[model samples]
Target: MNAPIIIGAGVAGLAAALAAAPRPVRLLTAGTLDAGAASLWAQGGIAAAIGADDSIDLHIADTLAAGDGLCDAAAVSRIITGGPLVIDSLRAHGVRFDAGLGLEAAHARRRISHVKDATGHAVTTALAAAVRAAPHVTIIEHARAVALDVAENRVRGLWAETAGGLVHLPAAAVLIATGGVGALWRHTSTPPGADGTGLALAARAGAVLRDLEFVQFHPTGLDSGATPMPLISEAVRGEGAILTDETGHRFTDELAPRDEVARAIVRHLAEGHRVRLDATHLGAGFAARFPTIDAACRAAGIDPARQPIPVRPVAHYHMGGIAVDARGRASVDGLYAAGEAACTGLHGANRLASNSLLEAFVTGTDAGTALAGEPDAAATTAPAAPPRRI
Candidate 1:
């Protein structure tokens, strides 16, 4: 029998495959299951209102504020409440978080659950491992999806370019969890593969898309003459790190919403002011708290503990994608989008820091759960790209 197909084996795709459960699943990734995903580079933790002093309402308000009050209140409340449950589900899958929650900019409380500074690495790695061991799931690595085979306004399957050649894969449903469009920009902090491939597929298939105008720029990317700069996570700023100009004058609020900070840096740079992030106040303990970031800094020959790291604004995340409902279903039937590929409207104008991971897991689960109750996938003569014979 044809199985439901999930594209891009990032956190969202892994979670969807796991949640689809005893139902057989076919997971397709452009690279290996463990590589090329932008999710692996996530340094900050996932946001969830599980802190003792935190409440769902406060989390919702904080998210809205970070989003510049452009959020959908209903969707914001719904998705934020799924945080604790997402944590619980991940733990059930053998993923262990750090002892305490982390605090980031725009949060009223410390509600970001993490595993050190490598939260994305830790979380996505665990989920991918669990997916590997799942009995009913089939992982197809290095198979880049080229197009969706939509006929009569419904998705039949997709055409992907595999190692041998282009082939048509039939599925009951298609969930696009491919990451954001950050890499499309010249100075993105995202991996090279995160170039809006899935978003393009959705557009080609005529899926409803929104928030395409809301790309976010991170202010603290290490400007180390790198192609895709390494991110100096917001958690560093939350921990008393400050942004400075050439003469060591602080230019912007270290903990403001990302857009404000990114704009400040850009404007300052346009005025010929050099920017740097001084984490000297954090001292040597910075390495203990953020080993991954410390390593990245060291690789660039900068000791963040003692020196001010060169910084600039770079494309970070996209707040818009294929618009989806609460169930992560997109405009087309038998086609769903999750993670950074789907615009659930939880993120209105901008995404609150670290909320990306939570959205990935929650939306993936929702789409998979919704699919569990659906009928089996139907077989059809799907279309292939590059004039390949099917």
Candidate 2:
């Protein structure tokens, strides 16, 4: 067997590479670190069972309920149980989660790991830096994987296009962590580059793509024409930010789960009523706590100190992808997936407030440990001939 090919250098891809440590692993990305990924843009933190009041069972239930009807109970249970361990591993890798705040968001207890509000950026950046330093890992940026090649019912390799031309790299195992399918929508908070490429590739290889219709719409994408629309953290509501219609009438409680809040905001828009994030209560202190939101509101010419930040739900995440077992292995042998691109039933219908990163950590290591038991091998060079363009 050759080194496993891990696609997408987002948090999940980085985790997969790290998990496949000591084994020659090639981690590939469609763009630069944090460039085409929603992982970096995540304003909230990772969900965990680190709090005394919050048990793993509770977190698992919330995830399944949010996942709507498509969640796998066993898979969700596995991720919740392993959540804290994954966070600890990332912390060991130098990812700084927000601490000493008592409690951050969503969790009934203080279980969230944050690095200020830019928690996703903190985690992804830390993982990418660590991956760069790992001698066993190889990162190939500016390479777009167009498809997965499967022969004998197993993933064989990937077809990628680079500045030089198309390159086909065969692997002993393939891990698809290419993030979500947010770009499929007309308006989205996702990076334009993460347009279901991994899902497409896996499906092309005869992998099952479930829950394609269940897209999670975030309640607060800054309603400006900013490239890669800025996300107003859900923590805002947890911190007393209220949602109101155009006439200053409160429509829905901000503390509700994301799906409810997003649906309410969408309803208001449909009824010709605009909604906004009211942060005036915090006064000047609000800007200091959520600098990212403050800056985004300021750039859009809205004053969080004085007025509400305009917002609308945009496709922010997908609760679906290449289906995987609790160990993050895909349907195909020697193939695994983690993070947003791999659906391990952690997110049944809708993802919990900050479980995406947690799942990446847990599943990433699970896939890694599973692969580590296998024998190592020489690096397999890509095929000399390229497939015809699509």
lDDT of 2 by residue, 79-190 (tens): 7888778778878988876664324334566666677788888888888898889999988899888877666677667788899888777777788888888888766888
Q: What is the lDDT of candidate 1?
A: 0.88
Q: Evaluate model 1: give its TM-score.
A: 0.97
Q: What would the per-residue lDDT of candidate 1 be over residues 182-276, giving only the tens digit for each residue?
A: 98899989999888888888888879999899999988899998979989999988888989998999988888888988999999999999999
Give candidate 2 misplaced runs (Cα > 4 Å).
101-106, 374-390
lDDT of each: 0.88, 0.78
User: Between which residue pairs do clashes occur in model 2?
Assistant: 66-350, 67-348, 67-349, 67-350, 68-349, 97-114, 98-114
Off-target runs (Cα >4 Å) in candidate 1 are 383-390
lDDT measured at residue 26 in model 2 versus the true structure, 0 to 100: 87
